[model samples]
Target: MLLPRPLLTLAALVAALAAPSVMAIPGAVVTTPQVRAELVAHAPEGLGPGRPMALGLLIRHQPGWHTYWKNPGDSGLPTTFAWTLPEGASAGDIRWPTPRRLPVGPLMNFGYDGTLLLPVPLTVAEGFKGERLDVTLHAEWLVCKEVCIPESGDFALSLPREQATAGQAEAFAAAEAAKPVPATGAQARARIDGQAVVVEVKGLPADWQGAALDVLPATAGALRNAAVPQASWSGAVWTARLEIDPQHTESPPALDLVLVRDGVPAGLEINAPVSGSWPAPADAATPAEPAATPAAPPADTSLGLALALAFGGGLLLNLMPCVFPVLSLKVLGFAAHAHDRAKLLAGGLAYTAGVVVSFVALAGLLLALRAGGEQLGWGFQLQQPGVVAALAALFTLIGLNLAGVFEFGSVLPSSWAAARARHPLVDSLLTGVLAVAVASPCTAPFMGASLGVAVTLPAPQALTIFAALGLGMAAPYLLASAWPRLAGALPRPGVWMAHFKVLMAFPMFATVVWLVWVLGQQAGIDGAAALLALLVALAFAAWAFGSRSLGVRARTGFGLLSLALFGATLAWALPAWREAPPAATAAAAETGWQPWSAERVAQALAEGKPVFVDFTAAWCVTCQVNKRTTLAREEVLAEFRARGVVLLRADWTRRDAAITAELARLGRSGVPVYALYAPGGGAPRVLSEILSPAEVRAMLAELPAVAAPA
Candidate 1:
């Protein structure tokens, strides 16, 4: 049934030629799931040969979706209109309406929701012989909720010449009201100051004084879309400090700005000229707003409360899935030194120091990167594919080591073994580091609020909060080491210890499996396969070096072979990791859970359906636990179905700026956030990080009648 390439193309062309042509109508309408678009026009004075015509593409969006403006801002394509007309007729550019700020995730877009009108002017040349004035338009636009969809329409309109046809007068009147007006007597100038742009405007009407003005850039890429403008007034001149987008470095000759006050639609337009020389580029991007804005923690949140929450969250972290794999290692270390109080105490302190230092260092680096304008949040390291691959390799080695594939001291030369023996505390410290590495991906309950506040605070305070979290995580072990009685209670070292250690290797291997899956979520299946191959080669390398059955000479040769095999595998794997495609989205239909989008949530609510959104990540152990146990239970699903609730999953395995922004808007900065939305449009009820089947059922049962099927 397969057709050849040339025949298939010819068949498609023949099918198109057979299709019926749509006739031109005065007001042509097209409807899609997201928008209802109409081409409306007016010829005020009956179409004279040289008279101009006003045509508008008016779109009415579905409850939750919106289309882009002339300057889409940050991420979307602007709506475009291509015209087809007779030889003597010409169409001008679309006169855009004043756009409103639509904040999506972390990015800010300039667009319109509900209804949009884009007006275009058409001119007819002298001596037009055609009896009818015909206009054909091919238009394209990107409509967005949380997700964006590209849509286009082809429209044809005809108006009889010499007959004045009254058109959609109301729509044209509204379009005129929504358009931007000239700032009659205002004068403005702009200058670059470091990474910031300073705009000074003078001679505005005296009545407009003292009102807070919202400044929007008419030129795309001129300013950071999400950045809050800093403005102050002095006498007749008003100065506003705005962040210049680092991606677009060179300033435009003239910065076009829209100034709005009191949520007005029609705004004053100012074209400001750049008057100063540009400064040398900085080595790194810097924050335009060095001080925290009002979005940070409120004054009521004391430093003590933040530290307390951080410490408590860290203590609970030990029980999270990400940290469970490391516990066995710690248990083995404790068993080896149960009877030796001095060594046990030393190891514990070393581990605690390791944990604290690592936490502080990671927090400091994250803070630095964020100050430099990176839209990052908790568990940032795992967001990098390279980092995930490295972690995979690391865990594989540890698992192989614990499985007795490699003996550090006996596997190789004596010098290496002696060095390891001399540095027992170093091993303990490294174990602590590994523990933090895994634990970082899990955001325990109290940790979210504490860390959210920490990021906005001064460096010293932020670090202190991080230090407190580490101390809490290390506290249980620290306490056990300090108490000789607890060590006495532990079973004495025996031959059974060896078996227990081997059993512990399974958890380490499990950790490796989890890490590979996490990488797959970030870099697709190819990346995961690469990491697996690398781990297999590494296992063989460990085996070749440590297998005592082989003679010394044979072992040396195989060791060399192992090294070469691993090197070759690594070379192949590295490229896969670097060139990997973005995380693959799972098919939503199969799981009965739609991918989360702000628009989807809004639409569902608008339809009177209760919504439950699971803000989760593959790397978070707690998220997986709640998902498999409570949320996935038959009872929970039945209840959801009974209540007509829509399930949405916001996957945070990969770095999503939109998801990050949503978390921030929800007053948290990390995942395992559960939001239950009732039918009506109000704040969704946030659930605890951990969930229970009983609690879920109770919440569902409590839904108002509106959410239940009528």
Candidate 2:
């Protein structure tokens, strides 16, 4: 026996109701009607003939529950309604009344908590005077208290033509006209400040509170979403922080501010203008500074202080974690040639020259990038996968060599080695290049500031600064070689020298490990694995090439095979590595946190929740140390949970454009940037790069006191 059509439809509806509905509104938990208004359709009781029938969305809410307006502040979905009307009848968009700002905790939600009327205007076609009008509506809305719940209802209303009235139509139309026109008269402004572009807005309403205002950048990827706009009020003026996209080199034509106040849209526009001067070309002579602060300093007292500092800094770099491994080999060389001051000095000078030359080259590259309107900074080279891959390969080779897999003792061309062996000057120049390569990782304390100025200054000034850094890096070697007596005071070479060589190998191996890790960050696990395989193959080839019994042709073939593998690895790995998605570096299991994204942060903030952002990188030792020692502690996790803080980690292991832009906005170019936001009013407090238990406690303590439990 077949079921009737209506019965079948009812059965289908029952099945559909049995399954959970997929909601467009996220995080909503409870939804109920606040108020319900009845409408009699097609009735001429209130309106004249030929007028469209109307209905009122009588919205009623459970006490303390609320639904959203068109512009859901910070994070709620706007109420939407779809109508199914009979033929020759049409309904206009929902007419929203002005909404109120509701602060739940730290977040500001745009909505209404009590009963309200949302008038929907319906039109009937001319010459159609119906006795009865039928209308259906599918209404979806988000209702919230602490958490939000989405709800929808299918509603139908019927009215007799005799009951329809014009007064009712006029009343609904008038209510809609009174709904606030999207707030206008506001505008945005932006300016370039070094690496960051600072954007500000003006003409916001004077009576506005923090919970009532929100600013959204119109351009995708032009601004970092994690950046919290710092809001300040001075009399009638409003100022807020807007960090520009650090990756943006050219000035954007215009900035669109999607400002919302209490669920109402306040559209604003601002134009960005280019202002800063460009660096001089590499070949150009350095320009003179103003007489007030002359480039040429007072000559008598410390003629070469900058150069000496650079050289000293370079020498100290041999002790830096990154440079120590490479420096150990040079130390061995020094021990071997301890008796020959000429050879030591010659090699030292050559190394110094190499360091200077490389620095000059780096400066030139920076200048070139600036001239082309590319925004770049120190460590920018490392951002390139090709550069990172090459470094990885170099470190791997060095590690293998140190492990006694092969000898680079004769790796240099015989002609060049012979010349260097005969001329100390040549040896020193080559040593300088080695020194610079080893020192690449340790951009010591004063280095960043100097480099920043160099990249922005004229050619001569930049070169001079570069020379100073190179000189500092090479100074220790130069100093040892310069004073033979001091060198002689060093312990005599013996079997201990062999032990020292092996010990030195560890540093090179350590460097290899660091490089591999960096590669993993840049290329993902797959890319890292491929590169590692290439290194192992190269090690095998070196072993084969060095075998005394192997025929020349066979050895040559093995070497060529290794080269091919390395080349193939480079070709396949570079682009894939560059495009790898960033993974969270911080151990979030302890904090029950996830990697941060703009959308997630925005959503959380919109819902009136406090947020904590941890910006960290895998390669940064300090960041790791802090994570393990302080941040990951159970006590800290408990505190975060107790406070209801939304934990977000912005990982910067690789060159993440979003992370970089965020850093730039915070007046920083490197991790770790820790920020804590209060519920609504207080400005966020930025934690120190090197976090401590006490510091974290102090910062957390500083947060505005949470309301006492009821």
Candidate 3:
């Protein structure tokens, strides 16, 4: 039966007014096959003004299904309670009890099963602003067994100032008994004992040899959740050992743990303050210490390891696509000084110096920009259209010279034929600089964590990391020049040098083409066309200047024309590039990927659907390659479809604050980050930048066997 708009509105208002008491019922409370949940206040006499009250949430789960804790160990989401309080009302933090470690094969989880009462404090203002309190809480939690379901509910209740015995005080009492007891006069410290982080506690019960001791870290992600935590009690002291997580980059200054004894509350939750240096990852010469002695340093924060990783990443960058054009330069430099040992060594050193200097300068600039509140990452310069266009022009000129279309002056005093050996420091230094300029657009696998930590570290340490990367990048050239044997292995310089040199020009041109495509993405089609026309004028200028017959006046005229064409191109291109097209994220438009937003991710998670996030940029060669070779495959598409996964791409080609924050949250500082979140309660599993279909298949196979949404 359909009614007129006004009549329907009036009827709804009447129905709502008639059933005001229905709000007291748990109609909007969430109930699933595995669990049922509700919200209840602990104020037996209705909440009074300026009084402290408690709220208890009753959650009951079917056998084998459970909800997570404040620290959900390995891979699970903590339960969340969001409230919309009436004026002058506030809610305190959730009081969490000690959780039991639930082992699932290789992974471990911390949570509660069966029935539980979760309590929180509700504080009313000193002077009540209103006659009644309209309290509303939105609860969201993940319930799981073999499969997990994300659920939420809206609950509201009204409390009048007049004291009324209407709240669940009994439930609150039960929760208080279940809560972990806070311990005083207790001091604890952590130390490295063999392969484990051992914590020793003082001021516990004497002769408590048989009582159980639990050391649970309040800081999630600091320790390995799957490892069985070992505990021992001796001589009125208790000791517990935990294995540190290898991937944890930063450590909390203080660790808080809830202690339990023999399935009973120890009345001793302690905040352990750190006072010692970090331990080495490798086994120290010192033997494993007794549990009572917790003075040995704990897991170390790696600086040398980070530097080594950075260097390795830089070495691998030479083979990445972005560095291909520079390879040709290296080849020419090599052939020119193949027989001169001193010149070769000098050139290599100069090149190495240039790379190191440039890397330091870039790192300084990046840090300065970050301090000034710019949301950016590595290869950020390429995000600017001006930088892209300038690089394109430089590559085009270099390509023309290599193709023999024009003759720039010799890199050394020797002529183009390289018949005589001569080396100039400026030329070698410039080669290193050019290599860095091109290499900035690419990020190899091992670079991520090193770069991520570099930004967060102090200035001097950060510079060291960047310097290490530069040294690695220059290793190949340095080795060839310093070691005559390596250089001697190359084929002797010959008449074929010209042919090889000319062939190298095509790669430079290809680099120019790629830059133009990137420009097109930054700008639009019209802007790209203008840039192409400008390139034509540039080519003409080069040809005119190189001509044997052209006089000075004619060359000058061509140069003027090129200058005018470039001016016109910039007039149109600059403005257009600044005006970016509506982005469909870093993923290409045809891949059916949606642009990422925190809201979108939250919404998808609330729906209990799986999500795959691709954090990438157009400047990242690895990102594009991975997209083409792995993520775009039909098999991957079928897998996604079968699992009902929502795909999102966080485009980092430009400055996106949210995306940068997300990257930092994931402990990454560069593009090509892939995160796969399963429908079950757990932290997202990160994938390698250089993705493989087999890895993706294996990741999917490990997920719980939940039925796909229809």
TM-score of each: 0.62, 0.53, 0.57
lDDT score of residue 11 within candidate 2 = 71
Candidate 2 off by > 4 Å: 1-318, 367-371, 409-413, 416-441, 444-471, 560-590, 597-612, 639-646, 673-688, 705-710
Give the per-residue lDDT digits (tens) of candidate 1, residues 594-693: 8876656656665667788888887877788898999878878877887788898888777766576567556566778888866544456778877888
- Give stretches of model 3 more than 4 Å off: 1-301, 410-423, 583-588, 678-682, 705-710
Q: Residue 647's C-alpha lDDT in candidate 1? A: 92
Model 3 worst lDDT window (10 residues): 285-294
Best by lDDT: 1
lDDT of 2: 0.58
- Local accuracy of candidate 3 as per-residue lDDT tens digits, 1-710: 11112333687667755652323533436566777887777665556655557765789889988888898765557888898887778888898756777765445678889887788888887677575677778887867665444566667766655555344566667667778776656668876544456787878655344576666667775676666678886766777878766444336666677776665632357776655554433321111110011112221465677889889988998888888788778888788788888988998999999888888888889889888977677778888877887888889988998888877642223364353324477778888888898796585465887777778777888889899999999998899899999888777788888898999999999998988887776666765676677677777777776654667887788768767876666666666665555433235465657776544554466577778888877778888888899888999877876777888887776556557756765667788889875543445677877799999888887655457668
lDDT values of the candidates? 0.77, 0.58, 0.72
> Which of the predicted structures, 1 or 2, would earn the higher TM-score when compared with the native?
1
Candidate 3 colliding pairs, count: 4
Ranking by lDDT: 1, 3, 2
Candidate 2: Cα lDDT at 102? 61
What ranking of all candidate models by TM-score puts the best one first? 1, 3, 2
Pairs of colliding residues, candidate 1: none
Model 2: weakest 10-residue lDDT segment is 284-293
